[model samples]
Each structure stands twice: as structure tokens, then as C-alpha cells.
Target: MHAWESIQASVDYIEEHLNEDLQIETLANVASLSPFYFQRLFNRLVNKTVFDYIKMRKLSKTSEILKSGNSRIVDIAMEYGFSSHSNFTRAFKETFGLTPEQYRTEPVVLNHFVKPDLILNYVMVNENVPLVTDGMVLEIFRRRLEQPRVFAGIEGEIPIEQLMGGETTGVAAGAKLWENFHKIKPRIPNLLPDGNELGALYLGNAKEGNCIYMAGAEIIPGTTAPGYQTFEMPACEYLVCGFEAENISQLYGDAVFKADKFMNRWLKQHQIRTAAFGVEMYYPPSQDAAYLEHWSIPEVDS
Candidate 1:
């Protein structure tokens, strides 16, 4: 097995045994490497020591349970292998800058250490080959829009840190924007009935540490929706990454995060230059599946 696969095996083991005591020697055996080598490889791939990764993951999970369940803090800590309440609180405060009691009373956006999707780092594909892993399918191809497309919806600005922090980082501003758009969508006129929605991110002000997020649907040109803002996506060639999930909720955060990482790596490997903005096309969800397509415009050569 490759080094990455070995590391991934150990990671999977760590996840499965998070509630149990994890020894370096046992993890090294899982990775089929010496203890010292396993530690080095894990740190290099995960950017965290094995101990730190396991602790953070446990804390992350416990935080969710705290928010949604009525479990006692001490019991939750013990369930996650924290030897004592004080140790758990100290670790939680060190990581999130809040005591477990404080966080449980009023939760906040947390920069969670999400599990690394290692396959995304190694997968490569083109139009002919689609990568499938963990019950999700990912494809990439090129598309061209023959004419400008107009989208009308609600717009909002989110801090770059919160945006990059994914779904666990407090209330999802983008999701709220989409919800607001849908609430007002019936009042808007001349929207295409194709059931496709667009969440476009404009990064022009990213240097200033903010992003503009627009959640809306495609509209016919010359169509006017009062009280709504319109963004015209110019005609251009785009590199599109398409993926499907078991449900719409699964498409956000984890799936999109992996797809974005893979897409960015693929672009860099192919020496492609992309525009400052990107669009996420959300198809109508169904009982069985949901689909999302991420579109990145490529810069035209002079």
C-alpha cells in the first residue's frame, strides 16, 4: 500500500476508536509502520499530531452532542475518553477559547478540525473517468455558456474566515441567504422554471477579507424582479466539477469542501487560470439523490 493509504487506514482506525484509548504502538501497527515513522507521516499528511487530531475530533463531536442533546458535560467527556472533567474543560477551552459549560449555554461558530478526505488529495480525472468514493461520485469537465446568464436573488457579505470555515462555523450565512431568497422567490417574476438555483461567490473583495454571496435562480434577460439584485454571469468557458449526494444537506460543507480541494488541485496541475468568481449550481433535490455543480470560469488568453 502507498504511504497515503497507510495513513488513511490509521486515520480510519482513529475515528472508529475515538472513544477508546489509542496507543501509538497500536496505531503504528494499523499503518504497518514503525511508531516513529507513523507519527511523522500522520503529522505530515494531517498537519496535526495523532494525539491532537484525536482530541480535536472528540471535542468536535462532543460539541455537537452538547448542542443537540441533554447529556451532562462530565458524562460526555468520559464517553469520549477524557479522564476527568477538568482535563476535558481545559482542552476544550484551549481549542475553542470557551469552557464546555459556556459553550453549551450559548454555542458559537467553531473552527472545527474536520476529518481529512484523503482521497481528494490523490484523485485525478477527466471527462472520461469519474471518481467514486465513500458513496459519492465526482466528475470534472469543461462547459461553455454561449450567452450571458442573469440571476436574481438575495445577496449578503460573509467574512472570509467564516466562509472558509465551512458549515460548522456558526450559522451558515449562505444557507440563510438561500432560505431568504426562496421565501421571496414566489414574488419574483420571469424566473426560469428549470429548478436550478445558483449560489455565486464573488471574491473581488477577498483581499479585504470578505466575500459576496448571492443565492438566486436563473432569470430571462430583460426580466426585472423588484426588490432583488441581479448578477450577470458573462459568457465564458468554465471548468465544472459535478458531484452527487444522498441528500441536499450532505452536498454542503463536507462534500463541497472535498470537491473544491480536488478542483483547485486539478486546476493547478493543469496550469489553468480561473476568474475571480465562481458559481454553485444546485439542482432540485429528489427523494433519492441531490446534485451540485461548481463552475469556475477560465481566463481567456490574450
Candidate 2:
């Protein structure tokens, strides 16, 4: 947490001078760090370089102003640090995959964070199906991911039972615990690689609407997250499994089943095992009820 104070200060400085032509050196000075180290650490902790993060945040908020239909794009762009209308338009297109006018035509890009904003209910809901003989049902083509640098995104390394709550109590607690994401100091977009829409999956006991919300994104080691929270996922092999269906819930059940199967196999081979907790990173919720992103539970040999 040494850099926590400095990072917050930098953010404050940026907000106050959002319209100014602040350079990287100026921002590094805000945090009292040398330019080179500040750039590296800031990217590692927050998942975006200082300039990019500031620009994106400004643009996201600017989009809000544009939606008001009161101010002109040129004025908004200048106010938010864009040098010209073309510059703002180009950046906006890259970030949102649409031009400003096109954006206004579509639905608002959801700005939900995976924090404590999720409301909860406590009621029992059962959606379990029998496990297969092998326990793992789907086959995943494993892909090597660049180890992402995540700041203190998670307090504790979560396990299978932790990632997916156990019974009724587990569901209730998980939902409430993950709701704090929506209450961000300054939420930034970490869009899903597939859809580029930034958000999280909210799972809960539907009978009572108790939900567990997992927010955050996969970033290269250079990128940074808000709150001085940073993470560097150690390099490891991952097994990815996906399920296609009309319902999102079944998709998870199948993916989890695969993970269970893999875990059992690993345990049999090693007698005991240690590894990073692996969780599903789902596609945009808008894709369909059938989308899922199931990651192999990250594990390290003991």
C-alpha cells in the first residue's frame, strides 16, 4: 500500500486538470515518483498507462455529457483534453468500437463495477445436476495467457468453493461481498476482450435474488487498476472450457463440472496440490443467455 496515497493524489490531480495539457511528467510529479518508475508501476497496478487512463475516463464521462444533448462535441472534447474533434472521435471509436454519433444510437454502455452495489436476498435455490463419471464434461482447448498484472484486486486468493458459493449461506454471503465493486473511487472501463463491453457476471440465488458479482478485467502486466490495487498473475497453463446453450445458468454448470473433473484428475496425480484459484470469465451478458468464460483453476505444484 505504499503507492496508495500517491496514486489517489494523481487521480485527484488529473480530475482537477482534466482539460489541461498535462504531460506524463506532470502526472508522475503528482504522485512523487520518477517518470520511468511511475509509468511502470502505474501500468502494473492500474492496468493502464497514466495518459490512456486519463483519456478514457474523460471520454467515458464525456459520453455522458454528450447524451445530455446540450453541449457540442468539440466543446466537450476540448474540455476533456482532446486537442481537436478528430482526436476525440478517433479515441472514442477505438475505445467503444463506435463513433460518438453511433454510440448515441445504441444503448448506454453499461458502467457497472463489481462492487457492493449489488442488492441481495436470502432464499434457497437449487440448480444442480448429476456429475458425469469423469466429473468433467466439456473439453477445453487450453491457451497460454500473458500473465496479467492486477493490483490488490482480491484480498485473498479464492478457491473453488469461494468463487462459487456452496449452499444457501454461501450464495447469500458471496453476493453481498462482491457488491462493493459498484462503489468505486473512480471506476474505469476494462472491457471484455471478446465484446469490449466492461462489466461483471452477477450470480445469485434467484429464488431470493442473492447474487455474487465478480468485476475486474484481464490486463497485461503493464496495465493498472484503480485503488492502488495491483496484481501480477504468475505464468501458468490454463484450460479453457465453454458451453453453448439457451440459458446462461446451464453454461456455468457445465463449465464448473469440467473444472471439478480437472481438479479431481490433478489431485489423483499429485496426492495433494496447490494452485491459483481459477474462475470463469464470461463473455458479455448481451451475447446471449448461453455465453460463458470458464477458466481453468490456476494451480501451482506444491
Candidate 3:
């Protein structure tokens, strides 16, 4: 198997055995690599040591369980491989800034630890033969816009860090917005050609809980509707990365996270700093395979 596929398998194994003791030698065997080389490759790709990743993942899962109100804190701790209640609480508090008890009572978004997705489909094709792996072509392009694009739909705000959490308060807000949008879509009127759904995250130096999240559909100029908002997308040069998905409906949660992660790494590798704001555009299959485009502006150095 290829390196990316090996890493992908390692991640799958880790997920399946989060509650069990995951040994380095065993994990390396799963990836068919030596322990030393596996550690290096895992660190290079995952940005965390094997032990650290497992611990963080456990804590993350415990956080969710705490919110679920289904089990005792001690039970959860033991179930996830923690030695004792005190140890679990200490690690949970350190990772999430709240004890398990405290989190259960007053749950808030902590530094949501998202499992990193293996970007197997992502290929930087400046190399030989221009190959396509995993039924998707990943490309980043810098485009200067000549005119502002207008979107008429709904807007909402979500906590920045909460973007990674499971069914979070912020995610609920977005879900409600989309729910509302779909209910009123037929009445909204003058949607632009092509079924492209537009979304934007405008951070603008905002704190973790103060990010702006907007979801809308591109519309022809001068279209307006009652109780619907309009966003005049400012003209700017944008770094856009797109992936053509073979199955669009399945491209939620992990798939979306992986694509965004790949785009971030690609930008960092090229030293292309991005603006606080970004947009996601979804296109329907008739145009091509259903695809998602992630858009951002290059950060200006002061």
C-alpha cells in the first residue's frame, strides 16, 4: 500500500481501539512499517506523537460522553484507558479547561480536538504524469475577481473552536439556518444559474466564540426577499481549492475536514498566508462531478 494509505489504515486502527492499549509496535505493524519509521511518518503527517494522539482522542471522546449524561465520570475514565478518576480528570481538565463534572454541568466548547483526516486523494501535480488518485483532483488557484458576487440567503454566527465539535451549539445554529433556507428556498426568488450553495466564515480577528458564519445561495443582482439577508461578496484575490467528489452527499464531517486540512497544509507549504475570511461553494453534478470549492484571500503583510 502507498504511504498515505498506510497512514489512513493506522488512523482507522486507532479509532477502532481507542479504549484498548495501543502499542507502537502493533500500530507500526498495522502500517507495515518499522517502529522508528512509523513514528517519524506519523509525526510528520499527523503533527502529533502516537501516544499524544491517542490521549487527545480519548479526552475528546470523554468530553462528548460527559455531555451525553449516560455514564459516570469514573466509568468513562476507565472505559477510555485512564488509570483512575483523578488522572482522567486531570488530563481532561488540562486538555479542555474543564473537569468532567464541570463539563457535564455547564458544557462549553473547549479546544475541540478533531481527528485529522488522511488526505489520500490530494495530489500536488507539479510532479510527473499528472495522475488522479481516489477519484478526485485537488487543485489550488489564485484568481482576481473583477466584480463583487452577491448572495441572498441566511447568515448566522458560530463559535470558531466549536466548528469541530459534535452537534455543537454553533453547528445547531448552522443547521437551523440551512433548515430555514431549504423551507424558504422556493420562495426566495432569483437564485443565480447553477445550484451553487455559498458559505463564508468571517473571523476578522474575532475571539473563539465570536466568528461569523454565513450560508447563502448565489443570486442575480438586485434580488431581495423578506426576512432574507444579502451579502455583497467584496472583490478580492482568492486562493481557491476544489475537490471533485464522486459522491457529494457522503462528503460531510470527516471528508469536509480532510479537504480543509489539506488546503491549509498546502497554503502553509507555499507560504501563502490567508485572510481571516473564507468561503465554501458547492456545485451540482450536471456542471461536472459534484464539487466543493474552498476560497480564501491571501493575507497582506503589514
Per-model TM values vs. the true structure? 0.85, 0.38, 0.62
- Taking all chains together, the TM-score of candidate 1 against the true structure is 0.85
Query: For candidate 3, what is the TM-score?
Result: 0.62
For residue 6, what is the lDDT in candidate 1? 94
Query: Highest TM-score, which number?
Result: 1
Q: Rank the candidates by TM-score, best first.
A: 1, 3, 2
Q: What tens digits encode model 1's per-residue C-alpha lDDT throughout 1-302?
A: 88989999998898888889899999999999999999999999887899989888898888889888999999999999999999999988887778999988976545567677688777677774799876678999888898888888888886766644232334456666777788998887889878478988896444577899889888877677777888787887888999987777567756776677778888898888998888898888789988899999887789
| Overall local distance difference test of candidate 2 | 0.49
Tens digits of per-residue lDDT, candidate 3, 62-135, equal 77678877798899999999999999989887776667888788766444445655653345543122234445
User: Which predicted model would earn the best lDDT?
Assistant: 1
What RMSD, rounded to one decimal, does every model reach?
3.1, 20.6, 6.5
By lDDT, rank the candidates, best first. 1, 3, 2
Q: Candidate 3 at 275: error in angstroms?
A: 3.7
Tell me the deviation in Å of residue 235 in model 2: 38
Candidate 3 lDDT: 0.71
Q: Between candidates 1 and 2, name the one with more favorable lDDT.
A: 1
Task: Name the candidate, 1 or 2, with the larger TM-score value.
Answer: 1
